[model samples]
Target: MKKYFLKLYQYNYWANKRVLSALTSQNVSDEKILSIMGHVVAAQYLWLHRIQGLPPAEVKLWGTYNLPQLVSMAEEIGTRWLQFVESTDNFDRELTYHNYTNDPYINNVENIMIHLVNHSSYHRAQIALLLRQNGFEPINTDFITYDRVITGQWKD
Candidate 1:
C-alpha cells in the first residue's frame, strides 16, 4: 500500500508540473486557471496538515497566486507529500478533521490520500477545460501517458 501511494503521489506531482508548465509556457495569465492551481496546492497542504495533526485554520481554498508562486508551492507541497508517504508506517490510521464549513468527519489515511489525488485530478481537468475554452490545447496528463514516458526514459 505504501509503494502504491508513493507512485500515485509521484504521478500527482508530475501531472501538476506538466499542467503548470503548459500554462506558463503558453503564457496563460487566466485568473481562473491560476486560482484553480492555487487551490490544488492549498488543498494538498490542508490535507497534509490534517493528516499530520496540524491546524489549518488559515488555509485559503481559493487563494490568488501567480504562476511562479504556484510553481514554488506545488513543488514544496509535492515534496512534503512524498516525504510524508515515505515515512508513514500505517495507511489505515484514522483521522478526524473538520471541513471548511466546520463539519467534522473521520477518515483513514489511505482514504484521505486517495481523495487528495482524485481531488487534484478533478481540478486539473477543470483547468484543462478552461485552457481549451481559452484557445489552448490541454496537456495530456493521463496515467498511461505518464507511465509510458517514465518507462520509456527511465532505467532501473
Candidate 2:
C-alpha cells in the first residue's frame, strides 16, 4: 500500500512539473491558470501539514502565489511527501484536523494522501481546459502517460 501511494505521489509530482513546464515554456500569463496552480500548491502544503499534525494556520490554503513561487513550493513539498511516504510504516494512522470552516474531522493517512492527489488532478483539469480555451495546447498529464515516460516506453 505504501508503494502504491508512493507511485501516486510520484505521478502527481511529475504531472505537475509537466504542466508547469508547458505553461512556462509557452510563457502563459493567464490569471485564471496561475490562480488555479497557486491553489494546487497551497492545498498540497496544507494537506501535508495537516498529516504531520501541524496547525492549519501554518500554511494558507488559498494563498496567492506567482508561478515561480509555486514551482519552488511544489518541488519542496514533493520532496517532503516522498520522504514522509518512504518513512511511514502505518498508513492507517489517523489524524485530527479542522476544515476551512473550523469543523473538526478525523481521517487516516492513506485517505488524506488519496484526497491530495485527487484534489490536484481536479484543479489540473481546470487549468488544462483553460489553456485550451485560450488557444494553447495543454500538456498530457494522464497517469498512463507518466507511467510510460517513467518505464522508458515513451520518448520525449
Candidate 3:
C-alpha cells in the first residue's frame, strides 16, 4: 500500500508536469487552463486543510492568473505534498484524525494518502476532458506510463 501511494504520487507529479507543458504552444488564452489548474490546487488545499483540522485558506480565484502563475502554483503544491509524504514515518500511516468539518474520518495515514491521490486524479481527469473539448489534445496520463518514467521499469 505504501508503494502504491508512492507510485501514485510520482505519477501525479509527472502527469501535472506534462499538462503544464501542453498548456504551452496552445493558442488558447491562459485563463482557460489556469482556471482549471487552480481548481485542482484549491481542492487539494481544502482536503489537506480539513485533514489537518484547520480552517480552509482562501483559495485563489479563477481567471486571476496567467499560465505561468498557475504552473508555478502546481509546482509549489506538488513539492509540498511530496515533502509531506517524505517526512511521514511508516507507523504514522495507520494513525487516525478528524477533518476540519468535525466529520469522523479514519485518521489512518494510508487512507489519507490514498484520498489525496484519488482526489488529484479526479480533478486531473476533469481538466483533460475540458482540454479535449476545447480542441487541445490531452496528454496520455497513465499510472503505468508514470511508473516507467520514474522507475525505468514497465512492470505490470
Candidate 4:
C-alpha cells in the first residue's frame, strides 16, 4: 500500500509539472494560476493535517495560483509528503480519522493519500479545461499516459 501510494504521488507530481509548464507557456493570468495551484496545495495540506490529527487548514481561493508561487508550493508539499511517507508502515492503512466535516474515515493513510491524488487530479483537469476553453492546448494528463511515461509500459 505504501509503495502504491508512493507511485501515485510520483505520478501526481509528474502530471502537475507537465500541466503547469503548459499553463506557464500560455501566460495565464496570475490570479487564476495562483488560485489553482493554491487549491492543490491546500488539499494536500488538509489531508496531511487530518492524517496527523492536526487542525484543519483555512480555505483558500481555488483556480487562482500564480505560476511561480504554485510551482514553489507544489515542490514544498511534495517534499513534505515524501518525508511523511518515510515513517509510514503497512499498518497505517488501517488507521482511521474524522475529517473536518466530522465524517468518519477508515483506511486512514491510504485513503487520505488517494484523496490527495484524486483531489488534485480533478482540479488540475479543471485548470486544463479552463485553459482549453480559452484557446490554449492543455497537456494530455491521463493516468495511463503518466504510467507509460514513468514506467515505459505501453498499453493498447
Candidate 5:
C-alpha cells in the first residue's frame, strides 16, 4: 500500500510539474487558471500540516501566484510530501484536522494521501479544460502517461 501510494504521489509531482511547465511555456496568465493552481498548492500545504499533527493555519485556498513562485513552492511541497510519506511507517493512524472553515474532520494518513492525489488530478483536469478554452494545448498528465514516460515508452 505504501509503495502504491508513493507511485501515486510521484505521478502527482510529475503531473504538477508538467502543468506548471505548460503554464510557463505558454505564458498562461489567466486569473482563473492561476487561482485554481493556487488552491492546489495551498491544499497540499494545508493537508501536509494537518497530517504532521500541526494545527491548520489560515491560508488562501484559491489565490493567484506568479509562475516562478508557484513553481518553487510546488516543488518544495512535493519534495516534502515524498519525504513525509517515506519516513512514516503508520498509514492507518487516524488524524483529526479542521478545515479552513473551522469544521472538524477525521481521516487516516493513507486516506489523506489518496485525497491529495485525487484532489490534484481533479483540478488538473480543470486546468486542462481551461487551457483548451483559452486556445492552448493541454499537456497530458494522466498517470498512464507518466508511467510510459518512466518506462521509456513515451515518444517526443
Candidate 6:
C-alpha cells in the first residue's frame, strides 16, 4: 500500500508538472485555470498539514496564486508528499482535523491521501478542458501516459 501511494504521488507530481509546463508555454492569461490550479495546490497543502496534525486554518483553501507561484507550491508539496509516504508506517492510523467550516472530523491517512490525488486529478481535468476551450492544446496527463513514459514505452 505504501508503494502504491508513493507511485500515485509520483504520478500526481509528474502530471502537475506537465500541466504547468503546457500553461507556461502558452503564455496565456486565464483566470479560471490559475484559480483552479491554486485551489489544487492549496488543498494539497491543507491535507498535508492536517495529516501532520497541524491546523488546517494555517493554509488558504481558495487562495489566489499566479502560475509561477502555483508551480513552485506544487513542486514543494510533491516533495513533502513523497517524504510522507516514504516515512509513514501506518496508513490506517486515524487523524482528526477541522474542516474549513471548523467542523471536526476523523479520517484515515490512506483515505486522505487518496482524496488528495483524486482532487488534483479532478481539477487538472477542468484545467485541460478550459485550455482546450481557449484554443490551446493541453498536455495529456493520464496516469497511463506517465507510466508509459517512465517505462520507456512513450517518448514525449
Best model per lDDT = 1
lDDT of 2 by residue, 1-156 (tens): 988988999999898888998988888888889889988878888888778877663555666667888788888888888888989878888888887778999988889889989999999999999999999999999999999999999974
lDDT of 3 by residue, 67-134 (tens): 77667877876776666566554724444444445566566656766776777677678778888888
TM-score for predicted model 6 compared with the true structure: 0.95
Q: In model 4, which range of ten residues has the least summed lDDT?
A: 57-66
Of 2 and 5, which scores higher on TM-score?
A: 5
| Overall lDDT per candidate, in order of appearance | 0.90, 0.86, 0.66, 0.73, 0.88, 0.87
lDDT (C-alpha) at residue 122 in model 4: 89
On lDDT, the stronger of 2 and 4 is 2
Candidate order, lDDT descending = 1, 5, 6, 2, 4, 3
**Sliding window of 10 residues with minimal summed lDDT for model 3:** 91-100
- Give every collision pair in model 1: none
Give the per-residue lDDT of model 6 (tens digit) for 14-131: 9998899899999857988899988888888888888887655344677778888878988998899899989987788888888877899998889989999999999999999999
TM accuracy, model 2: 0.94
Candidate 5 ranges with C-alpha deviation above 4 Å: 55-58
Write the residue-wise lDDT of candidate 4 on 133-153 in tens digits.
Answer: 878888887888988876768
Q: In candidate 5, what residue range of length 10 has the lowest lDDT sum? A: 55-64
Worst lDDT run of 10 residues, candidate 2, spans 56-65
**Model 3 lDDT, full chain set:** 0.66
Query: Whose TM-score is higher: candidate 2's or candidate 3's?
Result: 2
User: How high is the lDDT of residue 119 in model 2?
Assistant: 92
How does each model score on TM-score? 0.94, 0.94, 0.73, 0.78, 0.95, 0.95
Least accurate 10 contiguous residues by lDDT in model 6: 53-62
